[model samples]
Target: MKRKGKRKMLIAIIILLVVVVVGLGGALFFTAGERREARNLPIGHVNFKQLHDGTYLGKYEGGMYKWRANKVQVTVSSSKVTDIKLIEHTEKQPTGITDELFSRVIQSQSLQVDTISGATLTSKAYLKAIEEALEVAQE
Candidate 1:
């Protein structure tokens, strides 16, 4: 009788441990999925033809993460993006990714451009800020 009771207790402990581990794993997986979705979100564009010629300020802070562009300033002139400025960003190192992204927006006149490879989160944040700024300029 004593041996049987010990065996049952041991089995119960093992089951509880397994349950805890699985729950933690599931939580981590879901969190990672959310981050991935945010990073891959499709960037939207503004109808430059309908946007009034002016400067606009936009800002975006990415999900719980530190890698993001805090603010951006965009200038539109005659239905074209004339300038893009990164007002603030949160990169630990100087990567020039923001500069490259700004140049692309100015040249293409659109936010539907490829993101920088290693700085995907920062690129997305910058694009989002540009979109927001342009949205304000819309007619």
Candidate 2:
């Protein structure tokens, strides 16, 4: 009877350990996935023609989305970007080039400017937000 009780207790302990290990492994995988998604998001698919001419507002949400979040208010008339106002940008890791290129785009009405070295994605995201705002203005 004593031997049987000990075997049952050992089996129960093994099961609990396995469950704990599996849960931890699953959590780690999800965390890693979320991190990768924020760091490697594609920001180059923005279409320019979608932007309409006129003043518009934009907003960028924080968190993992911050990697992709950028907002700007742009005024476009006759296909020219007369003004660009950055509303809220939470670019935590993007390069300083975003700001430099942003000024160029506002003055040029074209995102054809060069990408900020090391901050290419952030630059794209800022343009995307500006583009998105202009697009909204068209409607």
Name the candidate that leads on TM-score: 1
lDDT for model 1 comes to 0.80
* lDDT of candidate 2 over 1-139, digit per residue (tens): 9999999999999999999999999988867754565446444433445555667876545335354576777777776667776666666653346557777886665666766777666666666676557556656
Q: How big is the positional error of residue 56 in model 2, measured in Å on the Cα after superposition?
A: 0.6
TM-score of each: 0.69, 0.53
Worst 10 residues of 1 by lDDT: 61-70
lDDT against the true structure, per candidate, is 0.80, 0.65
- Pairs that collide in candidate 2 are 51-135, 52-134
Candidate 1 segments exceeding 4 Å error: 1-34, 65-69, 93-95
The C-alpha RMSD in Å for every predicted model, in order, reads 6.6, 8.4
Summing lDDT over every window of 10 consecutive residues in candidate 2, give the lowest-scoring window. 38-47
Runs of candidate 2 with Cα error greater than 4 angstroms are: 1-53, 60-65, 92-96
